[model samples]
Target: MTLSSKLSAARAGLFRSLGLMFIAGFGATVAFDAWGQIVSPALGFANLSPHGLAKSLLGAYGLPNSDFAGYFVHFYLVGLIGYPLGWLFVFRPVWGRVVRRGGWLLGAAAYGFGLWILAIGGITALAGLPFFLNFTGITWVALVGHVLYGVVLVAVMRAFGGR
Candidate 1:
């Protein structure tokens, strides 16, 4: 293929990859809701869901929000950014093999680290915003949740790759 054709092909492939990854991510959200929203409350983990998870996972960068709209907006931004990140994190390894066999794990860890940093950075940048700035617990919540996200991503990558 000519360079232009190759670029077009690559773009198409990226779109496809992002679509698949987005679906996977949405599923992750649902699974998270199932446990945090449903099971957690039942198990007395009422406040141990995303709120806690984001704070813990995000660490210093973790911005905390209490309003449902705020929560969705924050995650919406994360999901949007995460779509492209999936390409950097997963595509090269699974498709190009640019990384080693453990690329998935590394990718996941990097992603977790990214979110952790985002938690602190996002909060700091938006500290003036009343919605999330007040929620000091965002650190713990994001930290824990992103850890779970990283862990699950690693598992899914392994399982899917194995299959």
Candidate 2:
């Protein structure tokens, strides 16, 4: 193939990965949100709800605190940060080389851990929030949510031809 054709292919691949990441990220966010709203509350975990993170992050930006604001910020994070992460890290080097060959679930599970670290450890620290939340139940719930997010993200991305 010509250089121009190769460049075109590369661009197409990038867009493809990005598109897959976008859809999968949204789905994962929905799953996490559902868990937070329904399951977490039933399980008596208050801090696991999305509102706290949304309120804190939006409040830092001088935005009015509301459920709508929180949900908006939550979706924005999932799309902008989470999706790109899956594209750059999970689907690129991690999935094909390590996960696909032997154990897809293991790889996806590991990706979930990475996501938790990025979201909880990195983002919380950046937002000046404590990494270890006061509510241990919330932390555990969040970890479980992140793992579920990773699994769903990988499955959706693969379904969308991200592999």
| lDDT of candidate 1 over 18-94, digit per residue (tens) | 65556556555554455546665566543334433344434434555445535564455454345335544654446
lDDT of 2 by residue, 1-163 (tens): 9999999999998888777778888887777777767887887775465666767766777879788877676777664465557656755575666555656567777777877777777667655688756436777788888888777777887787765
Model 2 global lDDT (CA atoms, 0 to 1): 0.72
lDDT of 2 at 31: 79
**Shift of residue 157 alpha carbon in model 2, Å:** 1.0
Q: Supply every candidate's count of residue pairs whose N, Cα or C atoms clash at under 3 angstroms.
A: 29, 0
In candidate 1, position 27 carries an lDDT of: 50
* Candidate 1 accuracy as lDDT: 0.52
Stretches of candidate 2 exceeding 4 Å from the true structure: 43-47, 61-69, 79-87, 90-102
Candidate 2 local lDDT, residue 86: 63
